[model samples]
Target: MESWGNSTTVTEFVLLGLSRNPQVRAGLFVIFLVMYLIAVAGNSLIVVLIVVDSHLHTPMYFFLSNLSFIDVCYVTTSVPQMLVHSFTERPTISYGRCFGQMSIAVCLAETEFLLLAVMAYDRLVAICNPLRYSLIMNGKVCIILALGLWTFPVLLTLVTFLTLQVNMCGHNVVNHFKCEVQAVLKLACSSTRINGIIMVLASSFTLLFPFIFILVTYGRIGFAVLRIRSAQGRGKALSTCGSHLAVVGIFYGTALAMYLRPQAKRFTNREKVMAIFYGVITPMLNPMIYSMRNREVKGALWRVIGRKVGK
Candidate 1:
């Protein structure tokens, strides 16, 4: 507890990270540190490829770049801190810093949810309405969509963050490694009926609706792919949409399971393990998923490598 003038509040939180065993902590640290570095490097490579390769300057790559950027940021928000806390005997975070971390996590999550939906739409346009793909998803339109992806999530997160700033009554021991909003909310001593309502609403908007939108958009894309007369055309269409769908499945599946499920009073080890899926594992997998399965991305990478070697 800390005092401000005459009032006392929780100024810091002691984080009970993943393991208490020093050997276990050391092992987890090495594995996660390797993952974190791979995630950052992989995502950064995609961004660089997209920027330098003019042929890849379309709506799909634009959104892919955005996704990569988000994954990089998303993992950075929690993983580094988690890594630090993992090995520490008494890992702690300041109250203000915890709030900031929670807020950023919320914003990035909401943004990625909406962004994935937008990517599905872009694929739908390219495959379903090929003739009008350029006209329908013009640069101006893509820019507008990108702006909305970044802006709207921040606004929504702000509302959720504000509602979460309730009286915690000096309960400052965080069960999980990171400052997850829901985990933090459990510490609040004040009536959290409004906060719960707001959380449900926010989750519905950010997680539920966007997930449904992606599914429906893919449904339409599936139909359009079937209509293609050429087997090669159909295969190409599937290839284009497949990587995005894979990412969507891993991301949305873990996210929905974590956020929309019935709330638990205590943050279980199972929940802590679940948090690693979306927070750490997903980002690491994303760039590899996109690059390995994507021919154009691979070609762009080789081209860049060839140029460097030639120079």
Candidate 2:
């Protein structure tokens, strides 16, 4: 089938970011750079603490470490280039590079979704079947689930990239800070039916299904918490899941708003703005959410820093 919408003769795309105003772009660059540094430092610290702290060797921290690693990859996939482009007069991306960015972003995003789902299940088992929690989420099982979470998304992203390759020629202007899948797909000169289908399927698997799982798991957890007589018990239970819930809400909310929403040319600017929430802000927030609210992570971070300072 012929590609949908207008066809361009160029192979690569030019990213027209938020502002052409030099002052505005300069300010954005500085702001994003600061955010990027914070994201890297915060997420990296989480990963380091998880590795060093023997107390954090459980399934929960296993998933938390992986989530931190994914966040690092997630932000790195798009943010630096975006920061540079914000300051540069002409921001151009090669077709291959665009595909690479999309592939990495989609893979990491989907992986995080799957990881979050696994975490919810972990929480469910811990709450609902505390005795069998260790059996169900043994080291072997955790490794297998984490592998699947990471690999499945990589495969899906590859398929999407192949699908896009068939129709990507000319009119390379991408009106966003990064080469988002939907935005890039809009520039294709070939039928996007396959791409759309794949995207929807991936979204369903990665976003909708996991969301439902988290809701159900949390519902069960809520019931379990209610049954506990001690107020401390109830508070502890809520505390365990609260950060994950917040991260889930922010990440999925912006992601769905950008991808699942109707595609209109007029919404491009709005979409780009929303993309920043998930791509940049969420990564930066995850570490803070866990560090400030999570007792174990905070303790581990403090210990690590204290050791470093002593050294």
Model 1 off-target regions past 4 Å?
1-8
Candidate 2 lDDT over residue span 1-311, tens digit each: 33322224555678889888999888998999999999999999888888999988999999999999999999998888988787678899876677678778888999998888899899889987888989988999999998899888888777665554446665577888888888877876676666777778778888888888889888988898889888897788788888889998999889877777566644367788889999999999999886667888878778888988999
Best by TM-score: 1
lDDT by residue (1-311, candidate 1, tens digit) is 21111224777888888888889888999999999999999999999999999989999999999999999999999889978887678999988788788888889989999999999999999999999999999999999999999999999987676545377677888888899877877887776667778888999998999999999999999999999999999999998788889889988998888888888787788888888998899899999887656889889989999999999
| Collision count of model 1 | 0
True-structure RMSD for candidate 2: 2.6
State how far residue 86 of model 1 sits from its true place (Å): 2.9
Query: Which parts of model 2 are misplaced by more than 4 Å?
Result: 1-8, 309-311
Model 2 residue pairs with clashes: 3-189, 3-190, 3-191, 8-170, 8-171, 9-170, 10-170, 13-172, 14-172
Cα RMSD of all models vs. native, in order, equals 2.3, 2.6
lDDT agreement with native, every candidate: 0.87, 0.83
